[model samples]
Target: MAKQGYHHGNLRQALVEAALGLIEAQGPQGFTLSEAAKSAGVTPAAVYRHFAGRDDLIAECALQGFRIFGDLMNHAWNDGRPSALLAFEATGRAYLAFARRFPGHYMAMFESGLSPSVTPDLAAAAARAQGVLTRAAAALCDHLPEGRRPPASMISAHVWAMSHGVVELFARGAPGARGPYPPEDLLEAGIGIYLRGLGLIPADTAPDPSAGTAPDTAPADPAA
Candidate 1:
């Protein structure tokens, strides 16, 4: 359907941008279609023409946030560093950076509880985002011992839980958050620990000098 003013162009984009601000300032509960339309200088009815309702808009917003987040992870892993574990670490750093930079979007993507009601477009966007992470997990799986590859769903869930635990806790005011550590070292230790438990890391080889002891993943600095 058509929207007011030829110049404003897409009302959907405008509504998404406006909703982001609302999410940032007032959080998901405070995000509303009427408020978004007001912020975008469009009628709420105009927003409805693009979205079925507030839930629909929130679902799209969540999916967009995931797309942005997935891109960050893809970029981090794009370097193709020899160590799949290293690439995983880079992805983690990128993920944390996104959460810190775009807390509103971060919250919307994970905490808003919007995915369940997403339309096909939003659902596809979300799946694409997850596919990026799933690919990375698959890479890490290669280094594991035979018969050790985690089930696809389990691996994706665990890695996401690990990454999100750090970001969400810090975002929600964890008292122990710390600044970003050397990505390789932190991830090496984490991957090492997890892998070692599953017998993935080669035990006979002396630890690489570059390998770092896990610097407390526990959030230490509130300002991270």
Candidate 2:
């Protein structure tokens, strides 16, 4: 997206961009509306013409983020083409890609502490994004015995938690930043371990995660 800052009729978008930049650089509550207005090259008072306040601006950012996230996850899922397991893995990779590609939006959507119910649109966007993962989880786990199968939502939540942990704990840090063992390898290995535990992947058939312990994953600032 081009940064159309403070254009004739796009002040709303400009302020949103400013808020996203601030969120990425200084966390959600670290900056003020006045600062955001300054960054967007507008008067602080001009912000109210499009948004009620900073939270409103942040909500817009979250809204946009969910839209983009949904698209990425959906694309990665790709109707579970080739193989459900492979597609699911791609979706996991896309999570890291999204956080790297849109740190501002990622922070706003997940780290901002904004209520999921802040707005109907925000809520709907969030649900749609979440639904993609659930669908993928369901597709991948469909072969499980009915009594043994975990709920798709539960599987999706587990994968989401693991992916989020990798990003927060390893991907963003110093020594872990594409180090001797990249976060990507950690995530894939972890996922493999998880699926093996679930019997979705048999140990003998699963890739020897030990072999790919090297940091050979593709370069991405996340999706770079």
Top lDDT model: 2
Cα RMSDs of all predictions?
Answer: 7.6, 6.2
* Candidate 1 ranges beyond 4 A from true positions: 1-6, 171-192, 202-224
Q: Which 10 residues in a row give candidate 1 its minimum summed lDDT?
A: 215-224
lDDT tens digits, residues 1-224, model 1? 22345345677887877887888788887867878888888878888788887777777778778778778878888745656656666777787678777777777777777763457776777777677777777776665565867765566667677767665544344323453554334544565566456544443344456666543334221111
Residue 150 deviation, candidate 1, in Å? 2.4
Provide TM-scores for the models: 0.74, 0.87
Cα lDDT tens digits for candidate 2, 16-110 = 98899999989998989998988888889988999998899999999999999999999999988877888888899999889888999999998
Residue pairs in clash, model 1:
176-219, 176-220, 176-221, 177-219, 177-220, 177-221, 178-221
Residue 205 displacement in candidate 1 (angstroms): 9.9
